[model samples]
Target chain A: MGGDLGPRATVEGTARALQSQSRLSACVFGPRALLAAEVDALPADLRVAAERLTLCDAPRVIDQAMKPSQALRAPRDSSLAMMLASIADGQADAGVSAGNTGALMALARRALGTVAGIPRPAISTAVPTRAGGRCYLLDLGANVEASADRLVDFALMGAVMARRVDGLVAPRVALLNIGVEGTKGSASVREADALLREFAGLDYRGFIEGDGIYSGQVDVVVCDGFVGNAVLKASEGLARMLMERVQATFEAHWSSRLVGLLARPALRRLKRELDPVRYNGASLLGLNGIVVKSHGGADAAGFGCAVGRAMQEVDQALPRHLARELDYWRRANASVACGRGVSGADPRRMDADNPQR
Target chain B: MGGDLGPRATVEGTARALQSQSRLSACVFGPRALLAAEVDALPADLRVAAERLTLCDAPRVIDQAMKPSQALRAPRDSSLAMMLASIADGQADAGVSAGNTGALMALARRALGTVAGIPRPAISTAVPTRAGGRCYLLDLGANVEASADRLVDFALMGAVMARRVDGLVAPRVALLNIGVEGTKGSASVREADALLREFAGLDYRGFIEGDGIYSGQVDVVVCDGFVGNAVLKASEGLARMLMERVQATFEAHWSSRLVGLLARPALRRLKRELDPVRYNGASLLGLNGIVVKSHGGADAAGFGCAVGRAMQEVDQALPRHLARELDYWRRANASVACGRGVSGADPRRMDADNPQR
Candidate 1:
């Protein structure tokens, strides 16, 4: 409801999700009249599927301009707040939004709290790779300056998400750095690298450069919010630019345009395979409840993907899995520390985030 | 000589450059016999132009696995060192390398030294934009954690390069951050934003996210090496993936294969437009002598592009322009600081890298 496209895309996307996922019921929180009208304006089949969708009145909207603190101080009647509240109140198994990220993150953290041993929930999303698989990138905008231990936390959380949400038995986790050399990156990354080398419950790959993100070499790439955000956005920009260039090339000549028509199916499949809309859903990982954040400018298909992502998390019980895996790590770390006298094979000490002792 | 693809690409690329630029002469520094073999292997047309190319025997090799400090400690007979020495000895106006980035930057800064008011050289390159224009991105991996002042210095250098090399009236310079808001980035970026707003040298467009880089709205984007490196590599990765995906799409089905043949010209043009080889050259800015770094894995065409970029920098005297523009800003800053009683403007103070007062 608080997205850039108003209620049109969300309502239409909700109808689409309901149509596709038969058991999925949506509680759309927005201005009831506006949502109802948008729902009525949908196509016949989708409109009929709207019977599974209910609307709640949330007149207030948190826009992109509002700061996180300012958003918290504002009225609780905002759509972002109400949606998270619905999750906390147990009326919804999961929630999704395309609102101001800072506002949504802050509100969701407050409403749902965080998982055990996790102070802040990080944002995680799967990016399309060259192998037709997905590589998960985390801390997209949660903590701007994650410490070395926080990076370890991100690796753990991201590995958990990749394993459960994406059905990977043992996800390959790597820290994002400028270079692959041991001495190439920031101090925190180096420290995290040393820790992850031994703190393994999963396959801990070494440092990965940004170019390797799409190479499909690693399953999960962990970084601070700043680096993650920059990489994701820049990748999106480059993808869009390439897609446009492809289209413009087809439109250059009449013969080429005719060829484009013949190749429409292949081109269309290429576009679909590489579309950002299909990957619009970003999971706010390490939260007590399931929440997915869609791109604000996403179309109906994109928003529907976010809804689908939320449903997947709900079905997988992602948060519970994260907690269980994290607890196992804590116990493993504790035993290792006790056995090794806190100096040998005790990688937990390398993490400043060791639950703050 | 230190790149992933040995001297083959470098020697062939030099021949190609010599063939294209009638006046361009190069002193190839590798094993003389090896380079001679590669030179003799070129096409007859290119071999004839290879008359202007001279081969200097550099028997020592510094592989990518070596650290920067270790590279310096190693024998100076390496091809990388000889290339810089040629430039320093006034035999060459510029130098290009596809060696290890850390080694290259370290060696170049040591050999060429830095411009006045700048302590280090930043890696700068032009990325293709949506509008068929190029946007300069700097500090690609030179300084991983650039301070606020370093970011400002990058902005100035990038703006000068854009103005002279690209010949824009006034480059729209921007600070790369996660979000555009004043409160949305790291402390250094925020401080640089305040500084750039009042610095009064170039047209500072304030903050730009990684996604906005390709929008063609700005001519220059400045960021720390870590963020810049991540965004750049991710972009290159994405572009490569997209190109491969397009090719795979064409080869998908039999009917599509016919369409691909029909659309070969258009598809070729699109591939040519988006190829990473076209943007291979990365200029090492702020150095006293011109140096361009090609991709380590670049093909002959890519390495030739790097040589071409070096020639362009030499022709335009990019380093001199940067020094002059930076001096202008310094004088402007000094006058404003005096007139405003040090509180009015004084963006220089905002930059902790202000030559230590």
Candidate 2:
């Protein structure tokens, strides 16, 4: 439905998700023949329930430089388009893909539509923290540049996801900046900080330094997509480099190998705890329906996890909750604006009548 | 003779350097009384030779909103001014400070002057890689925005330092970017990549991904100061967060404590291997003399290590080597310019002969 490896990984993933989650049902959308072939190839015990797998015959698009119309039109004849159509038609609650990120984003924007008042949809990823810990970071690579308003929306969406999905309550949200003070970052970050401060439902924790991302200091971290993308990539790079070094060190000598043997259990536990596949899926927030982007390099297992995550979002009615929150933000901002008698002033502030300022 | 922590840390560090390397001498610049007190406090075995600790009593200008003139114009009695004067007057081979980085950079610029043909100086930090690992990343936090030309200079300076100090024969250099391809970055990165491709002396590895920073894949990583500063802080934050988690995990339960005991040797080895104090110094590159900045939060141990690092730079004759290389770059660029008959065109390109259509 997505790209070259789409049908196979998606089929296997669907099978695994069915077996692991008893209540889950999957409606796979793609060329019916290919989907059937992939499902049929699965081991007998792992075969997906035929009734649960709904196949839509749509052609796939693969080139990166293809014109948007051509790319969008091609996917229409393939599984991804059918999946979006299913969501739009209320036949499917959510859709998940391991395809071109840009294409997926475009299709979601075109079909699912944005939450009212939200400027742009953000992609949020859960990164492994130290000691079996993890936190959700938003706008991983969705929009390259974001307005202060978009950042505020990201904060609200990220916090809601963390609480509902990760079970963190009244999540502490921090705006990522160069420093922790009010005047520390670019004009955008400072403005975002001000906007965040006035947000009614958020547990705003002021600014967080870059290092705080992995410190487990806050549950939800927000930033413009450009900085967020760079930071996420950097963290991924560091983890890979560390793992490589550990491997090389263990393989260096007999003594180190013996030491490695003693540390094998801990190392394996650490590896599983930090495995990207276990946490490889990113949810595109502010969309009308659930859509998760699995890592492009994800194998069968990773793809399976993304499917499970997508199912969870659908069952939990995350989009409904997000819409309600967006309503709350709009009403609150509107009331504040009315009180101030200023049409364009930011409402995320201490009201003049409330002497706190 | 820099900031409040200068005299004590500098004296102690100098003493350590002298004790470790008998070939070195240090000139302590500060209020003579303070320098004498610090010198007296050093252990007899670690104390420098009398002839080595030449004190220059210089007064200081201190104010919260200190004016540039107030900060810059040393009352002929200021320790910082005297220290720079010593370097300028040939009374010292290099200047080292544990003072305000801004003030030190300004003083150095005013006194020793920038390397000929270089626009601005860069600050480079040698980050520890895994075993047999070391990489120099620049402008840690010095210049927020750097031109392509300045980045080339940083690469050259970093390569020289890595070779002379870290012992890389022909250090592989890489431009730090979002992706490891020529076309995958902002306008500045793409331009810098093109410029760097022309420098023949360096073992130019193409764009390096973020994770490659600690992979020891390359010896020198170049970037403008803004991104560099963010990356550096994030890494430091992650390391600290990990250390804290390790401690907390060890202390969580009786069984974990027992496991901690069993893992003590390995943990200790890792801590020692990753200790920041052992590698928490940054060198100010492209200056007339060597100036290393210790972390502002450095304690005695950290400061001691910074001193050792400064001594290493002196031993390596880093300043002279950098000057020689810069002169070579200038001459090569100038000749290429002459050949192309375009006075200001970039000389780094080999395609100068083929004018654009």
Candidate 3:
């Protein structure tokens, strides 16, 4: 009832995901009647797998167009909020939804709160690269007005996620700016550059331009939400237009159409490799729980990818590892973290003297 | 002497351009000895046509890495400065350089000044679209921190360029923002949208996102320099990456390689259609004289396109038309123009009592 495809896509995606991960289980949150029909339609193998799933009866739906504030006031019986509540109450290991991004972020923040030293969570996802690889890009639209301090925190959390989630020991982290030159970006970006350089456990690679987003030279790219959202959407729009043009050109004349038939396999491979749906899941990094946001318009396979991502995070104990890492960094760098004009200064730095962090 | 390929590419491109435009002539600015050698190697027809060429002996060259401020202090004996001076003195109808962008913009502004009501000129160019067409995009790197009023000025200037240069009457104009939603971008974008709406002569289409730049949905896209530069470079980088990947995939397998052989003609057509060099010239808009900046690394064919663009602008009397239009807009909407706090506020509106524009 939450996504564009409603509960059907979510339930079917869950069934598909269950085939890959035997240990995983789900608590489906949607209107009970609709959820049951979707579940009943699952194949025999998945029907047996459905024995592991719990259907939490949530009748009301949160529409995609609802503003975050308006969605926040939605009945607790709504699927999205209830799904998040399950994670908050420790009844579920992780939560995944294909709901509206802003409303989802707002609800996730209110339900789960921030991890220690993180003022807010950032929306992050992996972007495919020409090198036949991918890089983690963060703050996609979470914090529109991210402070220098928040950017530094994103670098720390993003690096941790890359190391834990992507299996890299030292991820090459970069701050996204208008130009690669040191003098190119806003004051906050320059300051974030300085702050990242001071972090000992992180591998900060200075600045990367918008074009460098897909260069595959770095593992993690960080920026304020405004720039990130613009780059991601713009890249998607351009890629779609180029592909459409190529298809049109290939079909224009009989000669080209003959060649197009020959090139079909290679073209299909290219399309699959660059499909945005393959990288549909956006992690709400810096949150206290494991949460993944699927694209609202994503199909079953795309939403399954998001579900698979959530399953992976739960297996890795991502939130626990992140909390431990944040506590360790603040304790190690308490002196340098103090006296900065930066907002959302590390709480763990203050608590370091108390020995509770 | 200026671009990456030095005097050879510039000289050769000029020779090629001379072949197409019978009425055209050139004043070559470089080391007299090196310049003569290149010209001497031109085709027989072009050599005789050299009678129309003037070789100015400027011994110094501005390096691509030179800072704009440093380049400003470069000797008057340098090729870049000399070329611009030739335009300023009306010896050349327009100037084209495959030199450093920052340096070119700085010198163009200093030598030609802004048009009557424009505070600063914007760096603008046409980007190819899937519609088998191109649209103008501006402030590629000119004004990084544009105010709302400056944005309004950009809209006016961009519209004039689309109309006069692109030959479109009432060219649809839009302000590039993070989102199309009226509340998405910073305060300046919203205000610029409002200002654009009041201009009856212009076809204001409202806001477009970064992805819309190449959508061919609007005739002109205006943005602050930072976002514009990032988007332009990012698009270039992605296009290059995708093309490289396609080539790699085609060559990776025997089946694909065989298909690639059959697809060669179609592929070549696609490459030619998307070639960045074909759209290489970037106009320095809102300036009193026509100044075109070619890619510093452009080769003969690419530089030739820039030369062709400059020639087109000259034939059309672009700057004169822009000045006339700006004067008319301010005079026609004197009351509304006065009450606006937008920067580059129409000075003509302040002088409404004066008879002359």
Candidate 4:
């Protein structure tokens, strides 16, 4: 509710989502008067869908500059905290927000908590691939610089998302590295690659360069949050630049503009297929209750996509699935740690044999 | 000559460049007989241009999989070594190679050496920007995990390149980070920001996020080789994917096909501007002699662009300029270390003052 565009985009998005997804019911949280004004402005065709949308009053707003710590203290009336409380208290199946990312994650983690071993939740989203499919990229901004073990945690969560959400049997997972060679990238990514190779139950494809993320070869691409965020934002920037350049090309001459009109329908289809708004939602994985984060600058259509993501996560019961998966992963790794012979990297053998050989 | 496309593209590219740049000459390196065969088969139109080209015999070829260390030992007959030797021996002003990148760097650094303060050379390239200008992105794949000091060294080197090669005064330099906020990114980037702030003689902008690289507001963007290489390769891949998607959209329907025919001219113009081939050269900055690395997969037109970059660097006397700049930097930093109260962070007053205040 406190995003850059405030409730105008969020509430309108809810009405749109309600119209398209007939079963979805929404609890829109904001200042009472502002929320009422937006809700009252819905069009006539959406009157029946508006019946499923409820507005809840809140007195305070968590602005972007407020630190997560400052916002967490006695946040009784904030929209973000109230929305999470609804999910935590079992009144709502899932939640979606366009508010401050730091405050949202902090309040959601505090309210919903994480699965047994994961310290915090990760942000996972789908990226369009060259083959017209999706690649799930994780730790988008959840952890600034993840440790080797934490990257493995992201890999596990991302894999489960690809499996349960996309229905892949054994999603091919890879670590985003500078090079595909064994000795490349930061120490954390290198160490994570080694750990994933031995860990059971996941199909661990080897290292992948950033370009490979869009090659349709990998089902999940995992990286530290800084690199992940950089890649996603870089792609967004490049896409925007390219789209603008293409438009400028058509409008540069009247002859091309006439041709552009003829190609308009196909061009529009292409734009819709590649638009970031259509793929707006990013799931906060590891939380007990589902929480999807919409991009802060997302428009009404984009915010509607975020709502759709929350609905899908609710239907799949994603948090419950993740908890079960993590339970299996922990026991499996625990056994691998207990038995020296199982890993094949036994130090006892290394003493007598050349490690490289 | 040892690149993926081999000498077919390299030799053809040399002929093309010589034709266009009448003053340019080339030494084509390969096995004696093979080099003669390619040179002898040049088109009639390029025969006059071919007269300015020389063929140098080389017995060995360094390959994609060869370790840089192994390539260093007795590279007497390799084409890459011969090319660097020509520059080292003062027979040529600059060098361009489509050979193995690792071998090329190791051989060039061993042959020509670096400036006073630079330990190793960095890969620097001009990336096309949204405003039709270029941004110099450095350490594209050299020094994968750059230290804070190393990043500062890159900044100094990149600044010199922008000033000399592009003739810009005080080129705006920035550290590529996850967020523009001071608290974000890895410790190395944060440390580099502090170091850059204190160092004199350059326009040091605060941190910029990944997306800002394209804005054309900054003339130079610096990052560790790991991040730089990832950003670059991801961009190349995404651009290729987008271009392919655009073509597919045009060909998907019958009516769109006629529109594509009418739009072909403008689209062709658009492709040429955004094409990776047109931006082939990545200068090995900090080296005493100029060396440009071409994309291994580049065609003749692309390899020709690499040759053109080498020519520009030769004209600029980049290494000599870099040496002078580094001298000034070392002296400035040495004085900063000796002076007190000049930096505003005088530690002597710590007993009476709170650091934050």
Candidate 5:
């Protein structure tokens, strides 16, 4: 009903996730017959836990090519829209999808709305870094353009997520820019930098270059969705290309082939460690409810990871925590200039009533 | 005398480049005493060819922290200004530096103005891709924001570079965007896509996502400087991180340690294949003269690659070839719609007289 692999992968992944999170339950929203068939095919152990599964029939499917406007116009019975609607209606604590990103964002925005002080929800995911640590990068493909205030909001939300989820007391935050220098980047980024510095609660580390994303220097990297999306995909492309080359090189010469055989176990471990599947779940942050976007092309294991991510956010009550923190920031903004040297911020934009300004 | 490592790396790299390209000659611009010492310390063979090297004694250096405007306002006698002046004055065919990018771009643009059809110069360099090929990415950090027509100019310039330097007859060109769908990118990129399609000579391949940059699916990837710079640096950072992880994995356990020793040769070979140093030089394209920007942190061997890159472009007559192709495009535009359905391009902007329109 969702993603490229549709209900088959989704159902299997849910079953896989259930094995680990025993307390978890799901209302599978898709074609009733399809869900029923997949549910029937679940192993005996999972079938015994069938009482936890609810097949919420959603006959219509949103095609990958569907535009956000088109998706919004789609029937309420559509799987993606229905899944989001469940979250809105208080029937579901969280929703996860591997559907079209634009459509998901549009529907999610319409259904869940935003937490106070947040102009829009952003796509955020943890990127593995060189130091064997993780850096949370946001606005992967949500809002293409972000204002300075919006960027500040993203920083706050990201920091909250990192602190709460990643267990960091004061997670270091940085704005993604062309260079680390204050002089580099677009006017919006420069403005964001100023505002981030003023964000009273954030542990703002200023700017981080594209390469610095993986340098493990910061915990959260904020960017407008355009740059964030580009960086994420480009990095994935490079890693895939490099892995292919590594494999090819191992098989190139007979002498090397011998070494490749000896290194096979270690290489497998290395590949697993760097596997994109392990990092599959991308949280649509800043929303009033938790929604994880699994990679559409992901298999069961990858989708399972996405489910696991959602479970963690739900268990930790991510939305409520984010809402409370955002409220605190908004209230604090009236009296104090958040921090020192808050540059380039429009006073009109900083006004609480016009968050999008 | 510039860059992080200063004169020694430059002197050594130049010497290394000179050995490979026997016809190559250079003017070392820096403090006379320091240049003389480094040049004097060159290997015996390179020293024997000292007659070919000219040490231009410029007393001042442009610090890395200097802003572009600051560098521009600096005395014409400074080392950077002197080096670029040499290229402009016909004393040098090309200029190479590992100094400040913004400073270099400003100085390079001032010294060598833009070609007739190009509105501004773009920084382009080859990024190693998966299919054992190189993808030329442009506007690395030149124009933070580019118009639709300017993006078309980048494609033409990039295609010309690929054809002349890489010897590709018709390089497959693509605009870097968030999504492959025509509807996915910013307004500028969409317009560029339309304009690129109209350019009859280009093997225009529409849009490619970030991951596609390393997918080897396209020969040239075009973007505004901001995104391009971020992508380049992010990829470099990611590659470095992955390499480190691979090394650590090999050392994690006793059994893996034994395999690591046996597989050292293959790993070294892998490292060389994906070496960032091998792809060190970035050409300031669209400028009237050749200017290569080497990575500031690069060592002697890495700097040598940048010199080698500059030599290749010089030998291939890159600027001349680019001028001819651009001229061909301009002429063709008058008679034909470059291709079909060119969208969002300002007709006035396409005019040579209104380059900034």
Candidate 6:
């Protein structure tokens, strides 16, 4: 209902999620007629319990430039807001959307609220690294300018999600910078480094250069939204360009086409390994409830993957564990400005009354 | 001789350059005895002229840290400094080095001086786009924080180099930002957009996102060094990771290994097409003389390619042409600070007697 493709893909993805995992349930939010039509379109065998699909009639709010008050304000019964409200009311375990990113972030912040001790939430994406392993990049465009304390919070939250969601034990985390040296980056990086170094219950691997992200040398990379956005976009652009070139090269000559036929299986395998759909979902971390942002242009299958990923995160209790970790670390480092002890309570704990967690 | 692997690779590359182009003349600069030994290591017919090989016994000021003073303090008798001085003195047409990047930039600025109207120079590298075409990226770690005026200079300089160096006519220029929309991105991008829109000489293509860099939608991409460095490193890391995974996949099973062997030629061709050596040289634009920077880890073959690239730039009179263009653009848009006019002066008209440009 949120993305460019809208409910068609959402419905298809919902069916896939049910088919892929028997225990999984979905609360599809959109116009009741549209949701009903989408569900009706699914294969009979893949259809789930009627109660599993909750319909919330949300008016479409696709663009951010529209007046926030005029565009986002709806009759209290709007679909997008209702879905978030459901999460806040403990009716839904997690929320998933392939809609306008800015709108989604704002909705989640208002309805679900930020996690305890976190000033601002960050969006984290799992990118397939050159090492054939996946690495988590945080603040992927959530907050453009982050303070030292906020970055530390991002690292803590990212580490928890990587471990709980991805099942990585003792995940290696690094601060993304211009160079690997301690003194090489901006003031924020230096301060974050000092804070991260003293934090407990995590494996902090110091500084990582931009090259380290795809090198697969670390499990988690933390940076402000600006740098992370640039890296993610650049990688995506390069991947697209490479695929196009490979196709063009194969079609250049008859001999090359023959070679292409022979290499088709290998090439397809490579393409599958690098498919964006499989890695399309991104977690909006530091929110009270789990919310996964799928690509705006995602198809049904891609949206389905996002749904499955959201379920995984919810079942794993990533937000709770991260909240506890933040509490523990802040308490331990009470002398620091960002420490939980100094604040007398977790900063993210302010949103606990929102009913999401 | 200042890079990790110096005269050994440099001498070998020099020999290859001579063999490749009969009309090319190279003046080797380094410790006379060390260079003589390296030259002697080559076969008689492949050996370079002894008189062309001049030794300037410069003491190493810094081990790996590239300081401006280290380049400046290098003995006049030493190869690195002398080569730069020779270029400025008109004894040599161009200077190429697989040495410290900062040192090269500093020396080039000190000797050759900045181009007319350009405040700061930029290092632009041509990367193989996924579109089977080349795209130039500028400020690849030269100036971390760039002003609006500097960004405009980068666009103009990059466009000129793309046309003259890569042979792209009417090269399309793009300013890299967070999004393709004109209103999106940081304040710097917004300011740069306004500036580029007013410059009529540039074939400005408005805004391009980070993902557009590898898409081959534009001939030249411009950004601050900080963003450019992050993008370049991430791309390199991703490519390496992909190649490694392909190798690991091939080695997974006996049948896969056989498939890999059969597809070896195609893979080799792909590797060659993407090889960094094929595009190893990066020009320090805005300098009076031609200066090319090779990768620190470049081997003999990479070094040779850089030398050839520098020769091409010299042959095309890149600096002079850029200088004239900046002057023309500046005078044309005198009311507005178009290109060089934005920097508040004609940089090309600076005193040659000044030690620092």
**Of models 2 and 3, which has the larger DockQ?**
3
Q: Is candidate 4 or candidate 5 better by TM-score?
A: 5
Which regions of candidate 4 are displaced past 4 Å? A333-357, B333-357
lDDT of 4 by residue, B1-357 (tens): 766778878888899899999889889888889877887877788788888889999988787777788889955788888888988888888889988788899999998887654788999888888888889888888888888878888998999989988999889999998777776678999988988888878899989877878888798999888778878888888888888888888888898988888888988989998988878999998887789999887988899899999888888878777766665665667653333222333332421231110
Q: Write the per-residue lDDT of candidate 3 for residues A124-185, one digit (tens) a residue.
A: 99987766678888888777767888887788888888899889889999998766777667
Q: Poorest 10 consecutive residues of model 3 chain A by lDDT?
A: A348-357
Please give, for residues A7-110, the per-residue lDDT of candidate 4 as tens digits: 98998889999999978888998788989898888777777888899988877778777777877895678888888889888888989999888889889899
TM-score of chain B of 6: 0.90
TM-score of chain B of 5: 0.92
Which ranking of candidates, highest DockQ first? 1, 5, 4, 3, 6, 2
Point to the candidate with the largest DockQ. Answer: 1
Candidate maximizing lDDT:
1
Candidate 3 segments whose C-alpha is farther than 4 A from its true place: A2-4, A40-53, A327-336, A340-357, B40-51, B331-336, B339-357
lDDT of 5 by residue, A153-241 (tens): 78888988898888899999999888888988899999888766766766889998898889889999998888899999998888888
Q: Residue by residue across B29-95, what tens digits does model 1's lDDT show? A: 9888898898888878787878988989999877888899998888889999988888877788999
lDDT values, one for every candidate? 0.85, 0.70, 0.79, 0.82, 0.83, 0.76
Task: Provide fnat values for all models in the order shown.
Answer: 0.92, 0.28, 0.53, 0.66, 0.81, 0.52
Candidate 4 local Cα displacement, residue B104, angstroms: 2.2
Is model 5 an incorrect, acceptable, medium or high docking prediction?
A: medium
Winner by DockQ between candidate 5 and candidate 3: 5
lDDT of 5 by residue, B244-271 (tens): 8777878888988987787678789889
Structural RMSD, model 6 = 3.4
How do the residues B110-229 of candidate 3 rate in per-residue lDDT, one tens digit apiece? 887766468788889998765667778878878877888788778778888788777887788888876666766677888888877787777889888777877888888888787777
Runs with alpha carbons beyond 4 Å of true place in candidate 5: A42-51, A335-357, B43-46, B49-51, B335-357
Give TM per candidate. 0.93, 0.80, 0.91, 0.91, 0.93, 0.91
Tens-digit lDDT string for candidate 6 (A170-265): 889999876666645667888999988987777999998788998778999998887788889888877777666565656566776776676567
